[model samples]
Target chain A: MQLNESDLSWRSLPGTLPVRHAVVSREQLLLLCRDVAGRGARLVSLWGEDRRAAGVGYVLVVVLDLTSRLLLTESISRSPNPGFPDLSQLFPSAGRMQRATHDLLGFNFLGADARPWLRHSAWAKDAYPLRHDFVAAAVSAPPLPTEIYPFVRVEGDGAHEIAVGPVHAGTIEPGHFRFSVVGEKVLRLEQQLGYTHKGIEKRFEGLSVQQGSKLAARVSGDSAVAYAWAYAMAVESLTDTQVPARALALRALLLERERLANHLGDLGGIGNDAGLSFGLAQFSRLKEDLLRVNATVWGARYLFDEILPGGVATDLAPTALPILLDSLAAMAAEVAVLQDIYDNHAGLQDRFHGAGVLSAKLARQLGVVGLAARASGQAQDWRAALEIPPYDGFAIGSVLAEGGDVAARVAVRFDEIAESLQVCRGLLTDLPSGEISVAVGKTRADELAVGGIEGWRGPILVGLRVAADGRIARCHPHDPSWLNWPALEHAIIDNIVPDFPLINKSFNLSYSGQDL
Target chain B: MWKILKQIVRTGLVTEPAPNAEPRLLEHALHADIHRLFGRALCIRQVDAGSCNGCELEIHALSNAYYNLEGLGIKFVASPRHADALLVTGPVSKHMADALRRTYEATPEPKLVIAVGDCAACGGVFGEDSYAGLGRIANVIPVDVTVPGCPPTPTALLQGILAALQSPTSRVDKRSASTYQKTEDRG
Candidate 1:
C-alpha cells in the first residue's frame, strides 16, 4: 500500500504475520490514517501507552489491517501537554478508541468526541489509571457523582426513549442501550459499554509471560482458545521461539472447535430469539454433545490453557480420534437437517429475511471485520486468507453471504460451521507427530510483538510488550467487538425495538471483550 | 416440518440421570425438598456482575435438553422481580458493582445469591478489588453459595443451586447467617 506522502522509514516487526511499523508527527499521523482509509485499510485497534519513563511521553498506537499485512502507526507526544490529532474523521471506529485512550492516559484528541466512553464515573476526575504515575488505594475514591451521559436527544411528534440496562434481562454481560423510538419502530440506538472493565490492562503489568497467557484467555472467556493462541503467538514471536508442527496443528484444531461451539450455540440462540424455541432445543443439544467430547478429549469443556507459549499443553491421543470424528460426523448431518428446516420454515424465514440489514457499504465504512462483515459481503477471513500456520496447508474456501441481515448472518454461521468441521476432521486424520511443547527462551527487554488471530467473532489482536525486568510491560488484547459494536448501533436504525434482541443475537458481539 | 419433528424425536431426551451435577448428592432428597420449599419451581435471575462470560456459557447449558433445568423446576427469568435465586457471575467490576447491588435489592426475599464462577467466589485470575472493580460477588452482596471453577460446569452449577436450596444457612442473609457458621472449637 502506497502512502500519500513519500520518504518515510518503515521497520518490519518480527512475527509470523507481516507487520511494519513507523513513527510519525501529529500532522503525519492524520495524513497516514487518511491515506490508509483511502486505500481500503481499516483501523483494527487504537490504544495508548504511558512511556514517560523512557524519555518518551504518552504514545498513541493504532494497528491498521492492510488485509495482507498490518501497519502500525505510532505518534509520540513529547510536549508538556501530550496529545495527537484525531483519526476518527478517516475511520468511524477510531472514535470510541480515541475516547477510551483519553480516559485512560489523559490524552486530548482535538477533533474527537470528548465524552467519557469507558470511564463510567468509576474514578475521580484527575485519575488516569493507565498513566505511569497513577496508583490506586485499597479502596478507590468513591466515583464522582455519576457523571451525566448526554445521549443525543431526538425530539419529534411521537419520539420516546426506551432505556435498557447495564444489567440486561438475559444472562449476558452488562452494557446500556438507549433506543429512541416511536412505539416499537426504533429511530436510533446509542450504547454505553465498559461495565465489565475489571482493570485487565493494568493487571497485565508485572505478570510473567506465562501468567499473562492465563489472564489473556479470560479476557473474553467465550474465545478462550483463540485468545490463548494469540497470546502464545505473540510471546513466541517476541522470544523467537519456534513452536512445533504437532502443537501448531493441535492449536488449529482447538481454535476450530471453539469456532464450532460458538457458532452452534449462537445459531441456536438466534433461532430461539426469533421465537423458535425448537431451534434452541435441538442446536444446544448438539453443542452440549460437542462440549462433552471436548471435555473427554481435551480435559476441559472450554479449551483455555491448551495453547502455551512455545507450543500446546495438550496432545491428541489415537484412541480419542474416533470419538472426535464420530461426534463431528453426527453434528454435520444434524446441522444439515436443521439448515433445511430453517430454510423451508415460513415463519422463521420471514423473521430472518431482510431483518436488521446492514448495507455492505456501511459495514465497510464502519470497518466491520469477521463474520458480520462476511455476511455483509466483505470477504476477509484472516486465518484462511492469510494462511495462518496449519490453515495455510489446508483446503479452505471462502464463505460469504449477501443481504447483511439476520438470515445472511445465519447462512454465514452455517457455512462456517461446515467448513470448520472439515478443517477439524482433516487435522485429526492427518495429525502430525512431534513434541507438543518446548521452553520459550529469555525475552529481550523493551521488545513488542503483535498476534492477530481470526477469532470466531472477528480478528482478535494481541499487542504485547516485554518489560525491562522480563515481565509484561504493557498488554492490549483487543477484541473485534470494538469495531463491530458501533456497527450494531447503526444496524438497529429502523428495526422494531422488539426485534432488537433477535437482531442482536445474530451478531452476538462480546460485551466483556470490548469492555476490557 | 417433518425434518424438525424427526430431529426432535431422534434427539429424544438426552438429559442425564438424576444427581447429574454432583453424583454424590442425593437427588431424591434435594428434589423433594425443592418441591416442598418452592412448590416444584425455582425462578432464577442471572447477572453478569463482571467476569469473563465463561460462567454464562455453562449457565446457558443448564437450559439444554441434556441438563433440562426446566424439567427440574428451575427456570431463568427475564427480571429480578420474578427471581427466587440470583446467579451472579464474575468478579464485580466497578461499573457493574452498583447495578449488581440494585439487582440483588430487586429480587424477592427468601432469595438465594449463588456466585457462579471462581471470579465471583473469590476474584479469579483477574484478581481482587481495585479502581476498576470490587472483586467477588460477596464484596457487593451476601453470597449464599460459591460455585467455584474457572467457569463451573453445568453439573456443578446445578449442584450449587440445589445446595443453596437445601442449606439452611442459605435461607438467611450471609451477614445474619452467623449462627450457622460452625465454631472451630467444636463446642
Candidate 2:
C-alpha cells in the first residue's frame, strides 16, 4: 500500500494491522483522499478517535479502491493540533461523516462543513462520550435540554412545519424528521436521530474479541448478519482464520436471503405509501412467507447471530433441504407475479417513476453506496469488489440503474432479488459438507485484520485491533448507512413532500446502524 | 379503471397473505398437519419496544419471501387486541416501555409472548450498555416464548413463533430457542 507523504503504512503492526497507520498531518489528508478517490478507492468511513489507548486524540479513515481491492487507512493526532484536511468539499457525504466523528471523537475536521449528524442531544455540546477520560455511568452535571433544532425553512404562505416522531405511528425505529412543506408538497426535510444511541462503540473497550461480535450484530438489528459478518471478517482476518467453503456458501445464502427479504418488504411498504394497497398487501404477505421459510430453513427469520467468527453456527438440517428448495420455487412464482403487478400498475408507476431522483453526479459526489448508489449508477458492490469466499468464486453481477428514482431503486431491488435467488439455488446445489465452525483459537496479541462482507446493504467493513491480552483495542463495523443517509436529503430535492415516505422507504437506511 | 379492476380480478390480485397467513394450499395442508402435531394456528401481533430494529427485522422476515411463515396459518395482526400472540423485538427502551405495556394490556388473555433475539430475550447488547432506555422486553412485558438469536434467523424465528403458537401453553422452551443465542450477550 502506498502511504501518503504525511501518512505512514504498515503491513504487520504492533497492535492489529486493521488499525493500520496514523496519517500525522492535517493539510494533505484531503489531497491524499482526492488522489485515492480518483483512483477508484471507495471511502469506507471517517470517524474520530479519542480513546485513552491512543494517548492523544486522532481522526481515522478507511478507504477501499474497488479496482485493486485494497483498503487505504489514515489517522492524524489531536495533540499535534487536532485538525485534518476536509474531504467534504470534494465528497459532500464526507461532511456528515466527518461531523459525526468530530462530535463523538472530539477531533475537529478543519474547514469541513459540520452538520449535526447523530449528534442529537445524546450529550451537551461539550460532552464527548468516547473520550478516554469519559465515564460510562457517571452522574455528571444535569444536561440542559436542547432547543428545537432550527430546521431549514421553505418560503411560502401556508408553508408550515410539522415535526414527526422520535416515535412514529408505525413500529419502526426512532428518528425525528422536521418537514417544511406547503400543504402536501414538502419543501425541506431535516432528520434527527440518535434516539437509540446504545453507546456500543464506547462499550467495546476492554471486551474480548469473542465478545465484540455480538455487539456488532446489534449495531443495526435488521442488518445483523451484515454487521456480524463484517465484524467476524475483521477478527478472522486479524487472526488469519480461513472459514470453510460450506460456511462461505451458507453466508452467501443467508446474506442473499437478507437482501431479498428487506427488498420485498420495502417494495411492499413503498407501494403501500403510494396507496397501492394491492401491492402493499401482496408484497408484505410475500415478505412474511419468505421470512417464514428462512426461519424453517435457517432457523431464524432474520438470520441474526447465525454468522460466527470462524463460520456459521449451525448447518442446514437434512429435512430442511427439500423444504428450502420448495420455498425458493414458490417465492420465484410470487416474485414473478409481483413484478408483473409492479410493471403494469399505472398508479404505482406514476408515483415511483420520477420520485426521489438522485442524479448520477449527485450520487457520486455524495459517495452514496449500496442499492441507492446502484440506482444512481455508482455500480459498486463489495461482493464483487473484495474477493471473499463464495462471492469470489462466482462472478458477482453489480446491478446498475440510471434512473436513481424510487422506481429505479425498486427495480434494482427486484433485479438483485432475482440474482440472490439464483445464488441461493446455487448454494443449495453446491452445498458443501463440513463442520460449520472451526475454533478461532488464541489470537496473537497485537494482531490486526480487516474483513469486509457484502451485506444486504452493501459492503460492511470490520476493522479490528487486538490487544496483547486478546481484548479488543478498537473495533469499527462501518455500516453503509453513514454514506447513504445524507444522500436521502439530496435525493428529496425538488420533489414534493408527500412523496417523502416513498423516497425514505425506498432508501430504508439504519439510523441505529450509523449512530453506534 | 373498471377494466383494470376486471383485469386485477381476472389475475386474482396476485399477492401474498398477511404475515403468518399461509399460502392457500399450505394453509390447507398445514392446518391438519399442525392441528395433529401442535394444536392450531395462532394469530400473532408484533410490537417494537424500542429495539435496535434487528429483532423486528427477523420478526418481519419470519413472514417474507424465503421463509413464508404464512404456510402455517400463523399471522401477524395490525392490532394486539385481535391477536393471541405477541412477538416483541428490541430491548424495551424506557421511551417504549409504556407503549409496550399498553400494547400487551391491549391484547386479550391467552396471549403468548415470543421475545425474539438476544435484545428482546434479555436486552442483548443494549441492555446494560446504553443509557437511552430500559432493559429486557420481559422486564416490561411478560414473555412466553424466548427465541434468542442476536437477531434469530427467519427460520429460527418461525420455529420459535410456530412453537409458541403451537403448544400455546408450552413452557418457554429456550433450549430449541437458545440455539441461536450462543453469541456473546454484551447485555
Candidate 3:
C-alpha cells in the first residue's frame, strides 16, 4: 500500500474487507499508474461509472492486485470533457479495458488506443449505452452493416491474410480472428470478439443487490461458481454479513469441483486438437462422470443458479458425502492412468512441444493471469498467494512449468486437476457442521466493495457499488480472460497457421466473459 | 502403445449401449412420418447464439462414451450445409442474429431447429429486456423445438434433437409447431 504524492487525497473505506480508495486529479492518473506498476502492483480491472446525478461528472475506477491486499483507486473527473490520462502505456493490458470504457461510457482515456473494442458498430458513435441518458429501447432499431473492421495490415513480399469466423465450424462461442501469415508462419494475429455481448453490465444498474448475483453467475457459465461466490462476497462485505464457516467450505468445494471439471474438459480438448481422439474420449468421459456427480449431489450438471447472494442454495445431503467420496476416489484412479498415457505418448509430444510458445518475459509484459500465466512461469495463484479463507488453511501447491508451450499449458491443467482433487477431498472430509446461508439484509447505501476469487481460469474480481437506495449502481465482473486474451495474441506469434487452434484451445480464454 | 492396448483391454467395452431408437408417444405422433422420409442418421450443426457455454458443455457430452450420440446414428457436423438440423443454444445476441440466420439458410431443406437451454427457449435470466440479446432464439430464426433448462441435460438435448428430426415438416414455419406453443405455455 504505497501512495505517491500525485495521489491527491486517499481514504480507507469501512467494509468487511479492507479497501483503500484514492481521489487523483486527471493530470496525476498516468503517473500514479506508473508508480503503482513500479511497486509491483498488477492492474486487475479498469472501468468508468456515470455518476452525473451525484454532481460528479464521471468516475474512473482502477483495481489492482497487490498480492497481500486489493487496491481500488477512484478518480473523479468533473471536467466538462470527462476523461483521464491513459494507463495503457504503463500496463499494456489496460489498452482493451480503456477502449471498452470509452466505447460504453463515452469517457476518453487520453493517449490510449482509441479503437472500438466492444462496441462493434451496434450503436451510433455518439450513443454510449452505459450513460445515464442512454435508453435501452433505442437498441431495437436495425444496426449498421459492420462488414469492414480496420485490422492492422502487414505489407510484405509473401504476406497473406486469413480471416476466421464469428460463426465457427465448432459448437463453440463466436469470435473472429485475422492472421497475417507468410506461408504457414503467422506474422501477426488480431482477435475481434464481442459477438456474445448481452448488455450484462448495463442490466445490473437498477437491480437490487440480491438480484445482482443471478446476473453475475451467467457472466461466464464455466466460472459460474467463481462469479457467484465473488458477487456474494462483495454483497456480504457491503452488508456486513459474516457467512457461516460451513458455507465458506461449501463454496470452496464447489469452486474446486468447477476447476476439476474444466481441467478435464480442456485436457481432452488440447489432446483432441493435437490429433489425439483417444484423449478426447477418455477425458470427456471423466468430465461427464464428474458432472453427473455434481447433478446428483448439487442438482445441476453445470451447477447454474446453485449459489445465491447470501450463501449457496443447496447443501450436501447427510447420506451423499460417502457417495461423493467414493466417486472422487474412482475418478482419481482413472485420471492417474490417463495422466500416464498423456506423458508417455510421443506423437502427442511432437504436436505439443515447442508449439505456440509464450516466453516468461512476454507473459509478464502483457500482465497475463490465471493458469496460462502459471504455465509461462508466473506463479500467481490467488488461492496460494492471497491465502483467503479455506485455502489459507489448506495446502494448495502452485503448479508452474517453464516451457510456456502447449505442453506446459496441458501440464499445468493436469497438475491443477490433481491438486483440486486433494482440496476437494480435504473439504469433504473436514466438512464443518452449520447452516449453509445467512440472511443478508439491506446493503449499506453509497458503499463500494471488491471481491476476488480464484476461479478455474484465474482470478475473477467483482467491483460492486451500491446506490443511495440500496440498488446496484455499478457491478463490473472482470474476468481473467481480459488479462489472458492479449497473452494469446503474443503466444501465437511466429507459430504456424495450423497450430493456431491447438494454441488457442490451450489458452481457451472465454469470449462471453471478455465480451461482457 | 502396448500399455494403451493393455489399458483398453482391461477397461473393455466401457461404452454404454446406444440410446433406444423407439420414439416416444409425442415424438412418434409428430415425427413418425419424417423418420421414414429421411434416413435414420441425422447430421446436426450446433450454433451458440449467446450462451454462457454451459449448454455447450453438455452438448459436447453427447459425444462421450456414456451418451454416445454418434452410436445412435446421430452426429455433429462441422458445416451447416451438411446438417439436417440446427441445434442452437443461448439467447440470440444482436451480433449473432445475422450469423444464426445465415446458418439456417445454409442448412438444406427440411431442416429442423431445436432451441436448447432456458436462454435459447425464453432468454432465461437475460430476458427480452436486454439490449444486446433479442431474448429467445425464435426472435431471430424459426425454432421447431425448445428445450428449457439453465442448461438442458444431454438427455433432454438429445430428445429435443430427436423430436425435431422426427417431426414431419422439414422446416416448420415460425411459431407453428405445437412444441413451440408448449414451450411458451411452460415459460
Candidate 3 chain A: worst-modelled 10 consecutive residues by lDDT:
A10-19
Q: What share of the true interface contacts does candidate 3 keep?
A: 0.68
Model 3 segments more than 4 A misplaced: A1-18, B14-35, B168-187
Please identify which of the two predictions, 2 or 3, would achieve the higher TM-score against the true structure: 3
RMSD to native for every prediction? 3.8, 8.7, 4.8
Better of 1 and 3 by DockQ: 1
Tens digits of per-residue lDDT for model 2, A276-326? 866765777777777668767776566767898998887898998799888
The deviation in Å at residue B12 for candidate 1 is 1.3
Candidate 1: TM-score?
0.96
List lDDT for all candidates, in order: 0.87, 0.70, 0.83
Complex DockQ, candidate 3: 0.57
TM-score between candidate 2 and the true structure: 0.79
When candidate 1 is compared with the true two-chain complex, its DockQ is 0.64
Ranking by DockQ, best first? 1, 3, 2
- lDDT tens string, model 3, A1-516? 444734456565544344567766666666777777887778889999888888777999888777666677778877756778888887899999988898888888877788888877567667889888887666677655775678999989999999998888787889999999999999999998889988889889989877899889999999999999888888987877888888889999999999999999999999999998888988888898899899889878877667777678898998889988998899899999988999999999999999989899888888889998889998888877767777888888578999999999999998998899899899999999999898998888766688878898999988898998888999999999999998888889999998998999999889899998
Worst 10 residues of 1 chain A by lDDT: A136-145
DockQ of each: 0.64, 0.20, 0.57
The DockQ-derived docking category for candidate 1 is medium
